[model samples]
Target: MQITIKVLKGSDCTLEVAPTSTILEVKQQIETELQISAANQKLLLLGRPLNNEQTIASYPNIKEGTKLNLVVMKPCLRDSIQRGFRKHYPEQQAERLTNEFMTDFEKKLNEQSLDDLERFADSIVSRATT
Candidate 1:
């Protein structure tokens, strides 16, 4: 059977798949065609997320010509910050600092205070400079 996959902010693609194929298998196929990693892919059928272990046949609504939405999850903020730190610090130091920064940043975010968040960000910058 064939189905269409519409990627968010990306192009749509069609694939030939077996009814018994698992969601993970479909993701792998999408990865081959779109270059997006399976771990990052989230397939949705009518706004409901598909389970990795489930087969297409399990979803009675899914059939030939059916369209599935594909959302690609972005990398963690901590990871992006860690990469920036790696340019200036050793790997171990980068990891340690990234973890510490993310912990504090998350706490500040939870507080929902814009002024305090700005101060926290400024402190991070100052610490990085020194």
Candidate 2:
């Protein structure tokens, strides 16, 4: 059997696991993939919490290809802050770089505005000649 998991602060991944695998074992695999502690991760099977000792075979009523969502809840305010930082750091970096580039571009445009039309034409002609 196979299972699909969406981990919080992690990517959506799929694992080709055995039907007899315990919930703990599956969580261990997810921990290895997501690089987070499995102890903090919560596994929900069919909208119900699966105890640490629960096994996949316990839920024989559910069909194969069942979708499972794994969530990692922040235990405290500090953990939430850390997770927020990790999530937004790349976006903040991109925004800063874009602002810098836009500033430089605007400065260049402002400097170009002082040039006369004739100078602009001459520059274009020189480029064509080159």
Alpha-carbon RMSD to native, per candidate: 7.0, 14.3
lDDT per residue as tens, model 1, 1-130: 9999999998999999999999999999999999987878999999999999999999999999999999999867776799799999999999999999999998877977778779989999999999
| lDDT string, candidate 2, 1-130, tens digits | 7778876566788876776788889889988887766777888866777776877888774346776779886565434444555565786665565566667866776777545656899999999999
The true-versus-predicted C-alpha distance at residue 31 of model 1, in Å, is 0.8
Evaluated against the true structure, the overall lDDT of model 1 is 0.94
Model 2 TM-score, all chains together: 0.52
User: In model 1, where is the ten-residue run with the lowest total lDDT?
Assistant: 74-83
Give residue 75's error in model 2 in angstroms.
4.6
